[model samples]
Target: MVAPPDNDVLRASALHFQHHDGSPALQGVSLGVREGEVLAVTGPRGSGKTSLLRCLAGLDRPQRGEVWFDGVAVHTLGALARARLRRHRFGWIDPVPVLVPELTVWENAALPLMLRGTGRRRARRAALEWLERLDVDGRARSRPHELRHSERQRVCIARALTVVPSVLFADEPTAPLHRAESAQVLRTLTAAARSHGVTVVLACAGPRRAGLADRTVTLLDGRRVRTLHLPPVAGPAGPAEGAEPAGSAGTEGRPACSLSA
Candidate 1:
């Protein structure tokens, strides 16, 4: 497992990336995830959620503004530099999902480490350990086609984390799973990340699979709409000693701003 970062592993300020028609895909999105923090990005399809995650992972460079990871300005780096950073520090789970159907579960999970210079035998061994932690070790030699869809997804995740990245960028990390399995996956992800002090920026739609994150934020028409409302802290005077304490003044997960489309 990777050690905790002494500082922020991922931070971005006012990032703007556009689509082919000159339409904005993401606009003025600013958010920060500290090491060991899990933040969920939720929005409708094309609400800039995937784009935002891609920009942060350096898969797609933003047209304007900058993205920084672990104090390194990713937007300023060249292709090779970005790739190196991604390999060493970032684990990006694709939105559509990708896995080699011919490779066994162990091979698929260990491929990342092998590509990073771990010998195949050693990679396979370490990969089995990851599968054990994810509770799928019994499927070690099973190929992708032999497993169920949810199992494949979890294997892909294990592959992503095989290298113990400092920051994991998970786009649609949870998909097509029953509630029980989804919660199990989320529990595993956060617990594993916290142990290694890895920050997880997972993008998904819906209520975020029950017990998934410490905070959740929304994106609308290409910008972050503060989706968390913290209550006014109690005054030292103790809210004038009585008062109903404001009933609905402090709901938890509503957006601070709204966008027209």
Candidate 2:
């Protein structure tokens, strides 16, 4: 097996995976994430962003290829070993907010630490700190069902951050929030990760949402692509018509290339 770069904390090479029903999810996709870097994986729906993150996070094993973390072969690890790694070294945020209905907000946020054998008081302290940073501390005593959708999502973000994981996998983390709320949460998440020297792998559907990352890699049809943003051109109409490229584009200050699906 080939070794990943010395700088890459996580790496996937020529991965291939399919759903149980035989639907392709990732096709020969390969990428590397550097230590403490926020890497955004952007693509349209059904383009395999979630699948790629899942494979890298060890939530699912690819049918082919390999995943590596800190020079260890993640793809070769047993299911229980992967679970232990995730609980201790990684954090995850899904598109939707998921919390225990019976647990208070702070309790939910502290759950990971408690599960890992931390003292309840210490875990609660850490969880409350994160919730305050995410602007959700006021809801600490409330239940999940008592908060708005956006509030609940913020709690989820806080929960993920309380662990200060080595690599945080956020799959459309701001999906449930309004544009304003999304920006705030992203800023907090990215800033916290940076301050703590955490590597982040964030997945989003488009470029606008991926701007905070230091670098970005896009996927299309379960494969890597070089997407270009062509300026909109005026069409055959007076001042009101324009044409934009049909393909997606990378954010400014990063690599750019023509879209090739």
Candidate 3:
């Protein structure tokens, strides 16, 4: 088992999970994400990236192993406790932006704060600020169905940022957008996270997208196969320029391929 790293905001140790039909989805996966840093989990389809993300975010529990967030053992929390933690501390952006059909863009962005009992006006103000930052404020009065897919994704990002949660789990958040739109949204998201010191764990399918992060962890068939560490640069989003080559290691004694740029 890999031990959680010191000063890590989130850590997963030897996580093992199974699908509803008892098919193994994750096998002894371990990783750590530091506070205020972005870590991208990248892999091909059916490689367990989503499962690992869900387990780390407390949305699902691993059948074996441990998940820790800021020193708290997430696996031990009850359903209500886990729900409360998710509500108050963590933020999530899924592959698809799921929004309330009746709510306006700003209203949808402010939903989390409203659910937590913040006054509607205050929530709206905060939500608008994030929307503006994400370049979606012009559409604040529009309903979800009225916005384009890319715009909706931006609004979803605004919603996640409204609370400025300690950590954000984004699972292929830009998958529905075109290349240019994806890059734009990623730039905004990473800049916002850096400015606010929000830790981020982004799961994606390709290295090009994963390059936006400070580090990348690659998974193959439910196990970590390699780790890439990129040098610090001005922007936290987009590809790193002149980045050091990535390091690799075998999984279960199998030969690992290089992730070098």
Candidate 4:
């Protein structure tokens, strides 16, 4: 979502992540994603696409380099600080839908806000708005177990967007949907970002719908190779969910620095 241009967002520099054996998962990646922009990070499976996003979201830390959000270096933060930042400033949704089988659709959508201290009534009201925004209000009383695969996917998505964060980082995002449903979800996410001025950065395996990206970074052999911009295209306004607050912003990035390169 591009709300008046973000004052702070995120940037990554010479980032790398390693397994216990010291074999690399992601190596020396660097990039920037701005507010109101969507950057697709794509590559083959096992190419560190997920790991790279984890580093950006502070869910996984890199062994080398830094991830800066709103000018704060994530690599330097304590674990608790990073967690708070994630809750308040960043939203990360995995490619697959993760919904509680027993929770009603409204409960799933309202969880984030309720956790953030909003009253149940207020949260559910917000949840209804999101469901309506996504055209899923009719499913509000349905449990995840009661939904069709695609509807469950949207419920998961509605939950993710409910908190209205500054930046939304998602992985896969559309692997389960048919081509048309996948396209629809992409537009919903994109519109939510643009409408709220949130920045949406996603990890892709190279199949973004024809016009969802504001930029694309190709990761080849575990390293970033190039970056470019896509023309603006329209999408859904928002999912009535909250993501995270906006934080760091950086100018465009430099060539990815790498020890192995």
lDDT of 2 by residue, 133-238 (tens): 9999999999999999999999999999999999999999999999988988999999999999999999998898888999989887788877644334345762
Q: Which pairs of residues clash in candidate 1, taking residues 3 or more apart in a chain or in different chains? A: none
Deviation in Å, model 3, residue 187 alpha carbon: 0.8
Error of 2 at 177 (Å): 0.4
Can you tell me which runs of candidate 4 are displaced by over 4 Å?
1-8, 227-261
Query: Model 3: per-residue lDDT, tens digit, 22-77?
Result: 98989899888889999988876787999998999899999999999987899888
Q: Residue 36 of model 2: what lDDT?
A: 98
* Candidate 4 lDDT over residue span 13-40, tens digit each: 7887897887688778888787678888
Cα miss at 209, model 1 (Å)?
A: 2.7
Which is better, 3 or 4, measured by lDDT?
3
RMSD per model, one decimal: 9.1, 5.0, 9.1, 12.5
Model 1 off-target regions past 4 Å? 1-7, 228-256, 259-261
lDDT of 1 by residue, 3-111 (tens): 2244666777789899778978988887778778888887656678889988999988999887887768888889999999888888888745578988889999998
Clashes of 3: 0
Q: Evaluated with TM-score, which candidate comes out highest?
A: 2
The candidate that achieves the highest lDDT relative to the unseen native structure:
2
lDDT-best of 1 and 3: 3
| Pairwise TM-score winner, candidates 3 and 4 | 3
